[model samples]
Target: MKKSILFASALLASSMLFADSLKLEGTIAQIYDNNKTLLIDSIYGGQMAIKVLPNTEIEMDDCGIFGTDKDGTFKDLKVGNFLE
Candidate 1:
């Protein structure tokens, strides 16, 4: 099946310790619900597996396309969705 890709504006996360967080933009190549992880084909030129913790925050912020931001759950994550 063909996969869909989504993009969003840059994300800036701040921590109390002022540490810089690693940011990546990528396409969701695969989803592993059993492990709560995603296999991402990164635009940076490689594939990475990211584990989504229970505390992970998921949001759909496509104001330009969807008109508003929506809180998202793990079930909302599908193969091919762009993540950053």
Candidate 2:
């Protein structure tokens, strides 16, 4: 029983480490034709895009080159902007 409990705990901890959180930020490299998706250049130096849900809020910071704007959209978020 003790061994089983230890194993379970270890597995849980390892799983948590590998879990992916969905806080994405990046430049809008390309907007899909449907407009529901866009290609983003992630701050981590990878290109990826995710579908946006209805009524979702996109926020950004207020400083830096691509800082967040008053409308929650980042400033100068063109094809070569950095996002976090």
Candidate 3:
């Protein structure tokens, strides 16, 4: 049998290393499209499984030399991408 771990976004707040509304920096380790969840490997030496809810606000930043910033959707997320 396979066991799946679910990480609720709310837990970040009460984490010993995190404060309320703390921003997380990490790389996208895995993407579960069917459930709209992402497994992230944090630079802080931790992993997080975040589920994307329907009302969750999403955004992508423009770090390219000449790219413009724009709104983003879950479909735009990819493995190996760095996020903050």
Candidate 4:
């Protein structure tokens, strides 16, 4: 009975990890479109890789390059750009 209860609780915890929303706040490091992975300079520490979903939204503001305003997109994001 105890073993069964522990297994049930473990299953429940694992399922919740997969179901919860994941948010990563950081700066852009490297973007791999083919692999659908984004590398970020995480505020928590060094860089980390986060998976990108089809529904993920990337927003950019106050972006300028050498005095030219720029919008952030998959193609426009650079090494120094911020991501959340």
Candidate 5:
């Protein structure tokens, strides 16, 4: 049916938008609070800018604390910290 075809097409298109993701893991090079952006030193060997939205979840990996690590905020993120 036309509805089925349209739904499939829409699903395929949306999937394509998320299909080409490259993982970048590196240290946080800088934070620009005014611009709401963070600069990361990419593992692939360079720095790139990633925008920080108010709702963006940033969490740190801590092994020994034994409880919720603490909700992240921009102020708690340090420039030397590693991230993915």
Candidate 6:
């Protein structure tokens, strides 16, 4: 019974984590001039951008696509956006 309870708790925890994971889907709202990035507005009013590989679909958890630089200059990102 203890083993079963632990397994169930683990499953529930994983499910909650998965639920918080971001899943975005929409058209390319904007694309940077560098030809390496694009913005996407999700159907639920959230927006973010992922690094592009010429003509590939956007994905989450891809580091180095957005954020600020050492000198505080924003990197590959614009206003009115979030990091999903």
Give the winner by lDDT: 5
Q: By TM-score, how accurate is candidate 2?
A: 0.45
> Model 1, range 1-84, lDDT digits (tens) per residue?
123222221122234334545777998999999999999999999999999999999998666865888889889999989898
1-84 per-residue lDDT for model 6 (tens digits): 999999999999999989857576565677676756668886677766667564443233334657433322224445444434
Q: Between candidates 2 and 4, which one is better according to TM-score?
A: 4
* Residue 34 in candidate 6, Cα distance off native in Å: 0.6
| Residue-by-residue lDDT tens digits, candidate 2, 1-84 | 999999999999988987776577777787665666668888777889867556656654468777755545322245565556
Best by TM-score: 1
| Candidate RMSDs in order | 14.6, 6.0, 9.1, 5.2, 5.7, 12.5
Tens-digit per-residue lDDT, 1-84, candidate 3? 122223444454458555555788899999999999999999999999989998877788897997777888999999998988
With a 3 Å backbone cut-off (N, CA, C), the pairs that clash in candidate 4 are: none
lDDT score at residue 81, model 6, on the 0-100 scale:
44
- Per-model TM-score versus the true fold: 0.70, 0.45, 0.68, 0.56, 0.68, 0.35
Model 4: runs farther than 4 Å from truth? 1-23, 63-72
Model 2 residue 27 distance off true place after TM-score fit, in angstroms: 0.8
- Candidate 3 lands at a TM-score of 0.68
Clashes of each: 0, 1, 0, 0, 0, 0
lDDT for model 5, on a 0 to 1 scale? 0.85
- For candidate 5, what is the TM-score? 0.68
Q: Distance (Å) between predicted and true CA of 67, model 1?
A: 2.2
Q: Rank the candidates by TM-score, best first.
A: 1, 3, 5, 4, 2, 6
Cα lDDT for residue 9, model 3? 41
Model 4, 5-52: lDDT tens per residue? 999999999989987575667887888878777799998888898786
Each model's lDDT: 0.82, 0.67, 0.84, 0.75, 0.85, 0.60
- Pick out the ten consecutive residues of candidate 1 with the lowest summed lDDT: 4-13
Residue 50, candidate 2: C-alpha displacement in angstroms? 1.4
